[model samples]
Target: MGSEKIRRWESGALAHAATDPFGPGPVPWLRGSELHFDDTGHVVPWYVSPAAPPGPRPATSPATTPRPTAGGPRSADDVHRQIKGFASTGAVTPGEAIDFHITVDPPQRFGVDIYRIGHYGGDGAGRITTSPRLSGIVQPAPLTADRTVSCHHWWLSWRLRVPSYWNIGAYVAVLTTDDGHRSHIPFTVRDDHPADLLLLLPDITWQAYNLYPEDGRTGASLHHAWDENGRLLGEADAATTVSFDRPYAGPGLPLHVGHAYDFIRWAERYGYDLAYADARDLHAGRIDPTRYRGLVFPGHDEYWSTSMRRAVDVAREQGTSLVFLSANTMYWQVELAPSPSGVPNRLLTCRKRRGPGRSALWREADRPEQEVLGIQYAGRVPEARPLVVRNADHWLWEATGAHEGDELEGLVAGEADRYFPRAALPEHQGRILLSHSPYRDAQGAVRYQETSLYRAHSGALVFAAGTFAWSPALDRPGHVDPRVQRATANLLDRICKRD
Candidate 1:
């Protein structure tokens, strides 16, 4: 956009193009938006112009902690930057491509006032200028559902021109509904860089949750992860960034940008290579597993799609390492049913199966494709009690520069009540890095604890903190252990630099 566009400032945003980004157009106004950089005028999406310099990040804090903890480093894919990969529902290559759709729960009333979608990046403490990548007026479309299904839903697709040069990263289609509702779906842009990964996900074996169903153990979905009743109430609006103010219910529908943000902070505190892929983009060949030395599962990566599993396996076989720092890893099976907005019924919950009389909220199709891949939760109990660190000398320990009294970060990221014994550990022979001792749940009931290890394969490196979705909670100030951070960073470095 050159002289054709003008920037406008609203109550909280700097909008470009005097008009709404999504103007009145036909269904799927699928055309690339004309794009030219403000500084160079040479439009390209290859590298974040100015490029990133090596070394530690600048000292700073995000302007707001919206939820908890303090300033932390932000991931490049931290829901910020301009949205990419939503253009074609299929594989895409470099070229001038335009707009992508934001799938929402209920279709939003179209218009442009101040709709917020995806990660809204603002100036943080580093004195870094606000990232100027993503900010546009959203154009609304008619309320409709997937052509295949007759569900009452909505989707908002905005046009974006892929600069002559584009690179790989997690991107999504976010919808800021008219009623102020919002949801994020996955999308991807091809990597211009040749494959840097060495780990062969396919070559290695996939493991189920740490504490799988051990014969007769019990497990819980860990669904009600609330400190109190008050925590469970809230509503999310794609039209706005600030949520957690309204009253609402639980699971699958609730939104928490803060949770994403919190993980980023913990990521910064612990020095994690900021990486993320929208829950929606795992498939559609969005995650080019070959480009990375390793892939990391964000905590609470409970949702899984066929493409996601396949992507991970390929990376592992290629000698790329994988760090599943999440509990409930691929606990549910889901698919992207075309939506005008927020991804709905993507989880394929039991409720959908009953068609009416169904009672269970979760479903079989909801579980990760572990059975076929070689790993699946062994028990029905999804919940895990607070566990005591059991194994202290496992190889993942090389990451912990700690003494006997030292503590490693702990998270409830994993929720295994019991696990199946492997006929074999890693081929090279692996050991349990850690275990939960004296583990008990919120009700003070004893639950089975799980163990973690560095799998026995050239590409298979397993590091599990055995925590729930909010593992960062354990990484706060005095509660956070440097050993955890160091261990995590070391793992990332090893993977990224694998020869």
Candidate 2:
């Protein structure tokens, strides 16, 4: 009944949305009447727009990949002039060789250069590796676009091994041609070194929400609310499975932009001893949480595999601290399968149908996310709202001098999480409920967004900010709240010492 109403409501919205005032692009508010319009009358959804305008961008060394601007690639003409390519995998361990599939228009010879993202020089230092290992120019294979997916992955042009000296962090490879054209392919280099903190990149969530359709034909994503042509899709009409062989349509890919980079810039600037891994690392048992004192989830991490959830549960029991700095985490239950060529964790499967089958919602699967997160996804807050502090006496708020009922400006924008009833919880004192902000849900019902924290019997500490915008508030010039920064630092400092 709920699905039927949503479908019918969406149909009526589409009829009216066809005449969007902005024009024929993606109807930003096609999901419902909820939308945020900017000064120019353009739809600027909170999820896409950052709460704070970022500070000066890091400097790109002449030897490394050129960074993409806030505004995406200039035009089709501009893309052709710049070399574009993708790595075989999203991440690679140190000393492991990865293949690069390159496409150079007019079929030219291109070279590859690599750089690790860090604050080596300072806050604005983008690519820290001043001298990167450069590869010789090799002629690329003839350009041939994939028939099923309209992407030019011409051929495997170069295979490069990451040196042992390369630091573990986000790395970008610059593909440069003789004509001075340059494009970047970003990937993470995982580190096995024992560290106090483990930052898990939500690459799985990044790929699940990627709707990079081929030639504008079929839309692909785990989300079931909308179809490819900007029309509302019924519960069973959405794509159940999506492949990882396609390039991300969004600017500089999905996770590399707003949420993940915000945390990266702030964490690196503070000189935290951090290690990196993809979300799949948790599922594959590659991440032994016992080795690290804390695990950090930075962005919109929505999907979770059963194995990954169990791993985190055990980590908490074993006294490894955990922090979720974003909202809508562990809300969807997805399965990982091998690609056509047998690459593990290459395909994400999420059949969102209700009852007796593969249901995407963990709530319906008899495994509520609140069992671990302490809060479940409530809904999205279309417009920005201030995060009202409720537990100012908590240690997380130390040194910030925040008082109860004080509101942090626009820190609760985008999707939010709320404490929900659950069957099981570790025996402890009443959880420290943090922020409580009121917002209207999709049904136009008034609800309060909640951020929470607690400690298990094993002495493991867990913290959830309950909003997707928390990371962005850490370092953005205008959006940076001293309270938010101080709170995060307090937690990090305490977690490391607790180890």
Candidate 3:
């Protein structure tokens, strides 16, 4: 794969290029950066740099220092109305073409700058390529069908033929209008290449929480919706289905996206052999979990399809270690269906409570998530609380200097999980409860949270962090915990067989 020649699309034609674009070399642009508007109302490149002598490459492999853009809206209420977009798919392999469908509010020119998210000596991300200025238009208003908002923007704003040399990782396309408004569309580059660890991004859960069009008038998520009387409805009354065809409302970035990015930065900095994929890939049978030594769920992975659950179960049975870095995993039972245009897995349907005898929760369906996770959703924390260490002698806490009954400040918050003593549990040789933190719920009820690790009969190890703060603590500013970081590294080192 290292000797494969890199290719790019130019003026609707394929052109040959160097083998490793990120290697030590002059590095030709994917498409020349110099641009001018042509008579046909299209931007065209006016110059291309000639190949030059190769020099010593940077210390980093394939990452860039992203150029700063004007700060845009911070939330849905302040959304950048000037421009927004969504990718045709959540993940694409190298050498495949991906289409970007965009909408410009007042019909102006816009361009997309691509960047790969990673740890580049703390810069966090690097620019990959930039598209020529494209003519944008006001796409048709999103259509609402059965309480689902979908913007099937058929207009192809830009098509990127991903270079074969592009590394497999998370990438973001920044859509910027001529007026300086910017938004982001994130996608992952995946391949069949095997790695020590497989990182599954919680894309399904992201869509479930997305309230697109956040206009305060028309937008519905699996968690909240607006009634005809202009009142907010809770989860029970929210939309039962969600489509991935619309941009994330507000900042155009999904909730908890930063958590996954933080983990990526921390893990990549250690030079871990990691492969990336979307959660949908697991559901569609596209990812072979057994090929990797460990499978990692890095963020808020709450929703899970039956297929996804079965795949992981089978992988665990075959001795593939599992790591759940966030809480509330595999809580819902969902079904994937084709989009209106026949794209597979574009629509996610989860009837929270279909009828008197049916439910979307795996536990209610008699297949408790605890059987696989070793812990179940306990309660939501009203505020941050200390995480009390229970199994201080466990290998997971090695070199952390944590003593028995030690409390890590503010490590427990958001949703959490706990070991259910009387619940259906999987057959394991040994089990250890790592944390025993108690927190107050929104209803003022005091509940206990527990982080757990268990060894399955097949020799597979499953670790559940039991709190949403685990990933954030790995790299988030103001939340970095050296003890938590050391414990996470200890766990990953063993799972990846690096120890």
Q: Can you write out model 3's per-residue Cα lDDT over 24-113, one digit (the tens) per residue?
A: 111111212333222233543322222322222233443342233344211112133578788899999999999999888778887788
TM-score: the better of candidates 1 and 2: 2
Worst 10 residues of 1 by lDDT: 203-212
Better by lDDT, candidate 2 or 1: 2
lDDT of 2: 0.64
TM-score of each: 0.50, 0.78, 0.85
Question: CA shift at 182, candidate 2, in angstroms?
Answer: 6.4
Root-mean-square deviation of candidate 3 = 12.6
CA deviation > 4 Å runs, candidate 1: 1-158, 162-276, 336-387, 399-410, 413-418, 422-428, 456-458, 469-479
Give me the candidate number with maximum TM-score: 3
Top candidate by lDDT = 3
Of candidates 3 and 2, the better by TM-score? 3
Model 2, poorest ten-residue lDDT window?
21-30
Ranking by lDDT: 3, 2, 1
lDDT of 1 by residue, 63-181 (tens): 31111112221111111211111233322344645344433333234321111112223211111111222333322322211111111222324555545544333233332333332
How many clashes in candidate 2?
A: 0
